[model samples]
Target: MIVSLIAAVSADGKIAQSAEQSSLDWTSREDTRFFISKTKEIGTVVMGRKTFGTIGKPLKDRRTIVMSSRTGIEGVEWTSEPPADLVARLEREGVTRMALCGGAAIYDAFLSVGLVDELFLTVEPVLFGDGVPLFRNGARINLKLLETTKLGDSSVLLHYLLLK
Candidate 1:
């Protein structure tokens, strides 16, 4: 499976104001728009439990996979497996591609295991003095910038390929 991570971060590289806060609440409209459109194209989105809680339910017309130690979500799939096993399971299920929409830790898990094939990030204009970071416990991986484009008046979108 091709795993891609997508996130919108503050100028200081934070995804939220705090662990309790949601990036969707403060991220730019441009980033939201881009995220929605991209996720629609991808069709499958995998995120951590907290990330799923922020959204509160499965996204319409897409398969939502939540990574958690617990089991049994009614509408979406739940997994407690390691990132590599999860990716293998997804591949077995015939998923060609998936979006790793985040709450930081999930991003680190996938990236640390070297499963992320691509990363799309939107850099918003505002800064958070302290917040949840974009990635935690991640490895230092080489990235090849695929594209950089201005999203709005102050935001920018960066697309990168994780060098294998």
Candidate 2:
């Protein structure tokens, strides 16, 4: 299965101004529409518990998997499984692709494990100055540019393929 990381970030590389801050507050409507379209096409999304908390509910029309120690979420699947194991299981279950929707640590976890195949980043026009970054662990991962498109007058979407 193919795994991709998707996020809307500030020009300064921050994903959110605070833990509670939602992307809807800063991202353009074009970016939001693109994100929804892409994830729905992928059919499944996995994210960290904090990321899930920020969203407050399962995404409509997609399988929501929260990577957390806690269990029994009413509308989502909760798992503390490692990245590789989770990916393997999903592939076994016939999932063709999945998106890694994150709050930094989750992105780092899958990227560090070398599971991510692509990245879709929407860069907005604002600067957070200091906030949650796109990747918390700061690991070096190479990527080949695939495509770039203007999301709106003030934002750009960057697509890249992971270089293994």
In terms of lDDT, the best-performing candidate is 2
lDDT of 2 by residue, 64-164 (tens): 99999887569999999999999999999999999999978899899888899999999999999989999877678888999999876888999999999
Off by over 4 Å in 2: none
Per-model CA lDDT versus the true structure: 0.89, 0.91
Per-model TM values vs. the true structure:
0.94, 0.96
Q: Estimate, for each residue in 15-130, the C-alpha lDDT of model 1 and write its tens digit.
A: 89877777778888888889989998999999999988888889888889999999656999999999999888889989999999998889989888889999999999888988
Candidate 1: worst-modelled 10 consecutive residues by lDDT: 131-140
Question: What lDDT does candidate 1 reach at residue 92?
Answer: 95
| TM-score attained by model 1 | 0.94
For candidate 2, give the lDDT of residue 159: 98
